[model samples]
Target: MFLYFLTLVLMVMGLYCLIAKKNIVKKIIGIVIMEYSINLFLILIGYKKDGIAPILLKNVSVEELTSRGVDPLPQALVLTSIVIGLGTLALMVAICLRIYEKYKTFDMSKINKLKG
Candidate 1:
């Protein structure tokens, strides 16, 4: 509903930041924003109204669990994605730092112009 719309908007914003910004740091931030929005979208997909944890209980029937339980797959997938995203972010930052060490600037345009 509204959440889905917001997620889409957030994704667009992230894309705009990534494409329109010239600062390497800003681009990194944009990548993080996009990653967060994607994670949010995945979480939203697994959401259910009045849903209970996806767990098996002795008293709960299989049909009831199937009907009422929130999906666990999306949650698991999001968790894995988050870990991967973090690793990528770290790698990006490391590369950015190395670039800064070499060029003494975070501006991508300057870096391009100064390349020798």
Candidate 2:
């Protein structure tokens, strides 16, 4: 649907940022964007029309719960992915800071240490 297309567009924008940008920070932002788009896509997949929460109540049977509630697996997976992304973002920023301290600039072409 339209949501899926939007998600795809976000993902493409992320990839373009990653490929087209020279700054390490911009690449990190692109990675974060891609991660978010994927999480959004998973969340949308788990959505249901008129769906109840996944929590179980005493009155609800397994069959009724399965039929009435949205899937929890995708939600759980997205949460985990978010945590992982946070850690990754932290590491990336730390690396960028170190690189900036050493190189004094964020531009990819200006750093010549890799030429060896």
Candidate 3:
């Protein structure tokens, strides 16, 4: 219950940062935070109370392996997600830098040229 609450809190905080912040850099940070929170939640979902590593030995039977090993799918998924997040963060930061170069400011409010 407590973990769920914490997850919700993290998600809400990220959303608040993304929505309320005026700086483009801060918005990118918020997006990164949101991605991390989602990855954490996904990893937590696959965790077992008392589980062993999912290494396979020659003598280990299939049933024993299934009973004692931790789930590997979530770890793999999280790794892929982290890679994707890194790519996205890099793109966002590049765009923010370009924006800063053009406007010489980080505040989005100052970038009012598109308003019509």
Maximum-TM-score candidate: 1
**What are the C-alpha RMSDs, in order, of all predicted structures?**
2.0, 1.7, 1.7
Q: TM-score of the candidate numbered 3?
A: 0.89
Residue pairs clashing, model 3: none
Give, for candidate 1, the lowest lDDT window spanning 10 residues.
Answer: 107-116
| Ranking of predictions according to lDDT | 1, 2, 3
Clashes of each: 0, 0, 0
Q: Write the per-residue lDDT of candidate 2 for residues 1-116, one digit (tens) a residue.
A: 99999999999999999989999899999999999999999999999988888888998888878898999899999999999999999999999999999999999878777664
- Model 2's TM-score against the true structure: 0.89
Candidate 3 per-residue lDDT over residues 1-116, each given as its tens digit: 67867877888889899999999888888888888889988888888767777888888777877998889999999999999999998899888889999999999999899865
State the lDDT of candidate 1 residue by residue for 1-116, as single tens digits. Answer: 99999998999999999999999999999999999999999999999999989889898889989999999999999999999999999999999999999999998888765345
**Predicted model with the maximum lDDT:** 1
Candidate 2: lDDT over CA atoms? 0.93
**On lDDT, who's better, 1 or 2?**
1
